[model samples]
Target chain A: MEGNVKLITDDGLRLDGRSSNEMRPIKLQTGVIEKADGSAYIEWGANKVVVAVYVREAYPKHAQNMDRAIVKARYSMAGFSVEERKRPGPDRRTMEISKVISEALSSAIILEKLPRAEVDVFIEVLQADAGTRIASLTASSVAIADAGVPMRDLVVGCTAGKAGGKIVLDLSKDEDNYGEADIPMAILPRTGKVVLLQIDGDVSPEEFDEATSMIVNAMKDISKIQRDALMKTYSIEGGE
Target chain B: MKYLETKEIVYPGDRIEINDLRPRNGIYEDDSQYFSEYFGVIQKSEKFIDIAPFNSPYLPRVNDKVIGKIMDIGPTMWTVDINSPYYSLLHINDTPWHVNAGDLTRYLAAGDFIYARISVSNEIKESWVSMRDTGMRKLEKGQVILVKPPKVPRVIGKGGNMINLIKSETDTKIIVGQNGFIWIDGEPDNVNIAINAIKMVEREAHTVGLTDRMGEYFKKLKGGN
Candidate 1:
């Protein structure tokens, strides 16, 4: 509150001039990288992320699952991605993010179909305002589909939280820094199954339910955008 | 049980049906419904429903013709990379001629390319390739190109018509391996023409009227010059 910034203006708009239920604009594109087996680039609000999937030899040979393929994911942030120059390599936060993302994506893929192989997904956050994890997860899901990995469904993720005693969807950087709570969630849009979820700060049971519904509804729209991008890339006519 | 129409593109989680049809490539079944796993065209057979992936990794199967590059020289065998997750072995016994124990490099060095066949393949081990009969031999001259493995069938066309058209039109000899590797041999200009045509086929494999379009394309190329 250095500038005593109001979380919302008197007109009920958030600091970024968005309604409490509004999310930032999102753009998703598949097959952006020519050399990768599958690739996608995403822009959500102020976050920019690119993900590439490689169909390569599975390493740490002993770890390979004989009945199915393993999905290994790595989440990395550029040194200049944030306001301060962060150090390169995996940090504690990125390691945790990578673990959750890999688990979420593993559920979407039909791993049993690909025996003794590995699909490596690398997510690079070039610019991060807030909700980088959700943006990265959304991009990686499209990349995996682009790679032609058989998946049970496409996953979409988003963030929601209580700001100034009011829950909001897709919080921006300012709201995230000063918001009362933050909840990051991901789901299999087709099944409405929550695959990844983490709550930070405080929220009552009623607030939790409201935030969950808000995020899920927003994710449905995001999933459609993801589908359109993929369909356009493959030149498939119309929507499903 | 009714199945989805053929050649209709399906995405992950899109339900094809709840019928008892056997699911094949790019499809998975659940307790209540059958869902598509890949983003590709749907193909239906009498007994099962399958999906032909637009892009996929190569998985070696028995009797598949492959073009490989020698990666390493072992004691009596040479390790070859067949553009797949699994590396194949070319044992000395599979070679057409006898090679003495002293030097195996004379037959195939570490950097040479070869046209071979997957003679033996199983889930538990690396696939073994043979240079025996099946027109398997060292590639002396040409450029190697890769297309999607699933699209290889389309590239060859029905009864090898597409390949024959390209070959006779461009005055080039082309060998299309089942593993999506194409070897072109001819004048550099003609080879380029053939390569471009093969790529166009690969990119538009799902489209209709491809053969006629390709014929017109070759005619145009020949007529323009």
Candidate 2:
């Protein structure tokens, strides 16, 4: 579907008239919702995700028990969010994504520090285009930071897709639909750990290498933006 | 009103491009031209005047007096829904005296009247506020009428004219929430009149001669006072 879009002309310039590999615009805000302990809303390209982190008092749940705190992640999109309406509820696909995200984020948290407590992370995708899961996880990490619960590293969620015979760092809504394969990963920059990994469509091993490197570089920029947003909120050392 | 063109305008939660700065608070600015009546504030820099539109301005700062409600709370912190893009946090640690974060229930309950000051704000707008100071006490004894969030200025009027009228009529304390929840503690009749008055203003917030209609209605309520 994205291939049919006039985003790319014969010259290969994409929609919004950017060259290949350029990402869409992103606008993020932390603690948007008052009710949630930690809340953030991010508009990455066309994908809009609202992430809330609840740092409740420690409680025991068999499935969540670990040496550290349990970071439970839920990723879902609203039914009327997309162009085509989607039915609500945790379908099989969403459950799989949730499991992967929780696994990815658990590596970044100092869970051993929170033995009995459960950190419930909720990610609601108000609008989705191509990279909802990645945006959700990225915003969720910022929400956790906004809540002031300590974490080992900041996570950057990015999707690398093979399109037009090239690996793109951030895929727009249109490119996503037409791209060959979308590899969404949650990367812990410090540890160089890949937490959540999922792919749709086809990619060669060499292309995977290009995509991973592209995603990591892009994530550094994303992390700066996240830190900027948080620093601006708290008016930390360099904020005005 | 005159406009100021600048490089960056500080919005409530974020920043807009430098070129879009108009000195109006309620106006939207974009490239190519300017529209009338949108308010903007001109900040004089070394070489250029920074034009900041009124729409997206900064959140509450420390010692800056603003009103909000107790939306939710943690063991030691109560969240205030300030009339800005970001939420405000009031911590129990910043209180007047020793108060345990775990036992923060009795100090402030949910839905109670709160007028606070921003003690700290983060890039995420994770603000920490304090009610330990004087004049930041709990509100009581009045009927609250909810209005739309953006219509606050209209109901309160420029320089408190609208709210002043209500206070003149009923001698009640009115606490307005940025989230469209207003707490008005007043007599039964005044409360009804005030609610209807807010609804009318919200409907006609953009129309002409609202001052006249509001004055006439208040006169009728006062029997030509």
DockQ (CA atoms), all models: 0.45, 0.02
TM-score of chain A of 2: 0.90
**How close is each model in CA RMSD to the real structure?**
3.7, 12.9
Clashing pairs in 1: none
TM-score, prediction 2: 0.51
Which candidate's TM-score is highest? 1
lDDT of 2 at B43: 51
Off by over 4 Å in 1: A236-240, B1-6, B18-21
lDDT of each: 0.87, 0.66
Interface quality of candidate 1 as DockQ: 0.45
